[model samples]
Target chain A: MIKRRKFSEALFKALGLSALVLAVGTLVLLFGALLIDGVGRLDWQFLTSFPSRHASQAGILPAVVGSTLVMLVTAFVGIPIGVAAAIYLEEYARRTWLTELIEVTVTNLAGVPSIIFGLLALGLFVYMLGLGSSILTAGLTLALLILPVVIVTTREAIRAIPVQIREAAFALGATRWQTVADHVLPYSASGILTGIILALSRAIGETAPIVTVGALTFIAFLPPSPITDQPPYLSFEWLMSPFTVMPIQMFGWVSRPGEDFAANAAAAGLLLVGMTLAMNGLAIYVRYRMRKRVSW
Target chain B: MARPVDGPYIDSAGRGDWPKPLKAETCELSFYYGTRLVLKRVSVPIAECNITALIGPSGCGKSTFLRCFNRMHDLYPGTRYEGAIVLYPDSRNILDREVDPIEVRMRLAMVFQKPNPFPKSVYENVAYGLRVRGVKDRRAIDEKVEQALRSAALWEEVKDRLSALGTSLSGGQQQRLCIARALATDPELLLLDEPTSALDPIATASIEELLQDLKRRVTILIVTHNMQQAARISDWTAFMYLGELVEFGPTKRLFTTPAKKQTEDYITGRFG
Candidate 1:
């Protein structure tokens, strides 16, 4: 009976180990295929030039610039709003049904599909708000998509900070706002940062919402730069310009029927994956540093 | 000094001990955690610049009563405080609706059971109270930080590591850092809820000694499970049981002689 029990335990452990290996194997295969199809296509000119009808000449400069611009706005619009909402829900909100309702709604919102968010953005931001099919609209659309994730992560981080920390602050005669700003915010900053980056990572690869928001499929010129070619360089004109992000560009390429277009699309996929991994890596690194520094 | 009241003294103010000028006094204070009442009508006067200890068994509401002084009980919802905790010098009822808990806390600081140091530099942790109180002058904050750290007896050990994070210190050092953080605000009263419960014997002794010196500077009220520590450090000992103040008097008298049978039984370790 003991021999049978030991054999059953080992079999279950082996099965669990194989499941993990299978998941990693799938990821490795996907990366291998992307590398084989895309590596030969990567070059400085491909990075710098605008897209062309010929697949070899087609570059992703406009999409790259667009994604960068839209992401800047996404981070700018999302972080403060997400962090504030989290702080309100966690710290200030009363133990009432109203707070519970809002909390449950937010948790549910995180599970909503990207396409539904796209449709909502199409109605609210593009048409009703009259923002036009611009980078501003696309950024705002993606920002909405990631808000739930950001809020969830921020709330979790703030919650992870022990209650005694707040008690210590309050006992010092610090005001509620002071306690949050001083101890709560500073202590949970790394967690907040990790969440924001993860949100940004998710936002970076989103295609449907931006597409539904009416991003341009083919663009020859860059959006107006925030930094001017002259003095008094800062400008807001780029916000209203037409844009196409990296995922939408890859989607456009992959949908067309040709080997060359598919290969170029694969290359763009590689770049996009690289960008996402960089963001996730940074989040992990920040969390690791924070863990090393702060024990209690 | 007011003569030490003996044997379950419930109403000294009615007995005409009114003009003693207390630092603060809770008059028939009742506390509720949700629907369950945690503290019954507890009326205790805290003398200015003296150590008062509240002792009881686990869940006996000693900590709950201590939390009422600095409004620590107000941190969560479903917990209610009824009656008044009136502060002298200002003569304001802290439990009044208009009286801000923030302002009350500035005068009545608290040190918790576990040492919770903020994840910042030791200097920043100590300077935090003053900074939040709007003391922006760099020189003034630095001076106060040093003085507060010195007062907590942590200056010599942590002077070189002022820029180090508070969590990097030992548990005892961290508790002292919290005390310095409280002291940085220059509060009139310090409420300690089991400040040394997590420490080793030597660390506990140091903190108890620090309490004796600290009482000379600010009024202190501590809730402790260690009966001997209460006896050793506190001038006034208030023994509580089942949410009621069973007995209260001088520490020496309370420990040596029998006032209430429950207090005698608990102190003698017959039962908690």
Candidate 2:
């Protein structure tokens, strides 16, 4: 019996060690490939200049701006609504059949393919709403794609908070809004921010949805002012303008016949990777700081 | 200083006669979780400036009964209560269908078995209740937080590290910090549900001492399984069995000469 138990324990340790080695090995292999293939072409001109017809002249400036703009707008539009929905569902909503159904639907929505969301965005924002295939439309589509993830993550974070914290606030004569605003929000802030950053990262990498929604393949022009003059500066007509993002631009370059276009695509891929890494790194740092600040 | 009285005594009315008037009153109170009945009809008068200890074996609905005072049960799903709980002699029934629980909760605060402090600096955790009430002035918040911490008997230990996270405190200190957080809101009544059950003997002793000091300012209702704890801190005591109030009166009398045989059996450690 002792021999069997010892053998099983050794076997379990071996399996765990093998799993860890496999994960690390896969990560190293991928990073090695990225460095070998893409590192040589990475330079200042490649990052700061617009794409060119010539192989050597092409730069990723427009794509970088496009991705940044789309991501910023997506964060601005999606986070508040997603967090509010999560709070209402977790803290305030009555657990009737309707709420349960809504909860289930949200969970399922998080698992849906990003490409479908792009198609929906094309039909709704571009066609029906007449916004066209601009940065605004792409951002809106990406927001929809990531809204369920943000909501689910925020809900999980909120749920991680003990009921005792809320009870403590309520006992202190804090109103419902007050308790949530004061105790629940501050306590869950790190987790909620982490969820938002993660959602934004996911949105940043999404090419399928934006592609289906018709993000511009090449646009040399900067985005028009967010406000336009047809009616007044605050008019909704500003949203109809054309726009492009990095992923679509990279896809355009990669699919072309020219070797120069492929090189430019690799360079743009490197830039995109750098940007996403920076965002994720910032998120990790913020999470660490918050963990320290709220260390109970 | 007055000589403290001891031993159990009863008036001519058999047992369960209160020396003081009711500070809060519950009428025809019963609670249900989904289809399960947790509390039968229970009516009890809670006296002001005193500790009322609710004692029963596990699952006797003592904690559930305590939560009803501040409507903490409302946080749970499918929890329905049929009753009127009134604070003082006021006509406003706290359990009125139209009354907002948030407002009722502001007047009555609660502490739980486990200490739960917000994941914020110690200063911020105490200031949170005050801030929610719109006290934005930094100086005022500082003053109130200090006062609260002192009142909870924690200021001396935590004074230097007011900026520290609340969780960094030891278990006893964390419970005291929770008390400070509750006290910061200036609540009239405080509800504690097994607030010391998670603590070691030393921590428990400190909390018990703090409870004795706290009763002078805030009316306290504590639910405890410890008969000795109840005897130590409470001015009044209620013994419950199977969701029913078996007996309640002065703590000494309830412990020594319970009117009901069930209360006598439970208190004497004969049976629970």
Candidate 3:
């Protein structure tokens, strides 16, 4: 019986290892394929030039800038709201049916389809509010899309703090806000930042939501500069400009019946993947630094 | 002193004669969690500059009684405090609705079962209480941090690495840091809930020694599971069982003389 148990354990171990290998193997394969198809087109000119009818001359400059600005807007709009909501729900909210219902709704919202968010944005931002098919609308759409991700992660991070830490602070005569500001926020900072970065990375790759918000398929012009040469230099005009994102640009190219457009799509996909990886890397670095400073 | 310091004596009423002036005392203090009663009318006297140790078996609500002094139960919902935890001199009921828990906490400090230093520098950990009170003067904070660490018997070892993370220390040192954190505020009463329960013998010995010295500076109320620890460290010992104060008297008398049958049974390890 012992020998049979040992054999079964060995079998289960092998099965788990193979499952891990299968998961990682697929990612490696996809990355390898992107490199093979897109590496040739991924150069300085491709990065700097605008999209054109000729796939060879076409560049992702507008899409890259658009994606960056839209991401900026999304971060600005989403992070505070998400973290605040998370803090309120986790720390301040009393356990009642209303709060429970809100919690359940927030969690369920994270599982809702991305396309549904796009449809919501289309009706809400495009027509009802009339924000138009602009950078602001696209940003708002993506922000809504990633709100659940941010809130869930922030809540998870806050919940990770040991109760003793808070108790110690409270015992020291710290008020609730003081305890939260001094100990809770500082202790859970690394987790919250990691969550924010991961959520942003998720936001960066989103295509369906932005498209549903009416992002342009092709764009050659850049948004107005955020800083001006004149007094009161900061500008909000860029937020109102029509824009295209990396995914939408790639999606547009991938639809056309040509190897050249397909190459462009592949190259754009590669850069998007690189951006996502870089954000995730930053999240990991932040977590490592935080863990080094304050481990329970 | 308002109250004369007489030698230890157990009166006819079975209550120990308090030798020193009272720092605080709970009068018919009953605590409830939701509908269930836990600490049932526990009225233990905490003498000023004395170590009053509460010894009970697990789940006897000794820790719950300790928490009542600082209103720690108020952090959760549905826990009710009945009767009064009266602070001396001022003669104010700390558990009264008008009395803020934060105000109570400011005058009192607590050390937990496990070392719970903040995820900040050792200096910052020790300085946190002052910071919350808005004592922003750098030099004042530094002096208090040093003084607290010194009192906790951890200054010499950690003076060089004040900027080091509090959690980076050994378990014994971390507990000392927590004590230093509590001491930094110059609290009138120190509540320690099994502070050395999680430590090794060597660490526990050092903490016990520190607590003995600390009683001269501030009133201490500690809860310990180890009867020997209670015997070794406390001036007064309150033996509790099933959420009731079974016996309370001078440590020597409680350990030796028969106060009650249950206290004797538990002290002799008849059953928890």
Per-candidate DockQ values are: 0.76, 0.57, 0.79
Comparison by DockQ, 2 against 3, better one: 3
Q: Who is ahead in DockQ, 1 or 3? A: 3
Q: Candidate 3 regions off by >4 Å?
A: A1-27, B1-16
Cα lDDT for residue A235, model 1? 90
Kindly report which residue pairs in candidate 3 clash with one another: none
Q: Which ten residues in a row have the lowest lDDT in candidate 3 chain A?
A: A175-184
Assess the local accuracy of residue B154 in candidate 1 as a C-alpha lDDT between 0 and 100: 100
lDDT of 2 at B186: 84
**TM-score of every model versus the real structure:** 0.94, 0.88, 0.94
lDDT of 2 by residue, A1-296 (tens): 99999999999999999999999999888767766666767889787777677768777777777788788779888999899999999888887999999999999999998998988888899889988887789878888988999999999988987776777777766776877887778778888998899889888878999888877787776666556666666544334556677778888889889766776777677777877888789888988887777644
Candidate closest to the true structure, highest lDDT: 3
lDDT of 1: 0.88
**Cα lDDT computed for each candidate against the true fold:** 0.88, 0.82, 0.91
**Chain A TM-score for each of the predictions:** 0.96, 0.90, 0.95
lDDT of 2 by residue, B1-272 (tens): 11112212233354437547667866667899999988887766688999999999999999999989888887777899987787875656888899887778877778889998877789988998787777889999999999999999999999999988898889889999998988988887888999999999999999999998988888899999999999999998988888877777889877776767788889889987
Report the lDDT of model 3 for residue B28. Answer: 77
Candidate 1: Cα lDDT at B190: 90
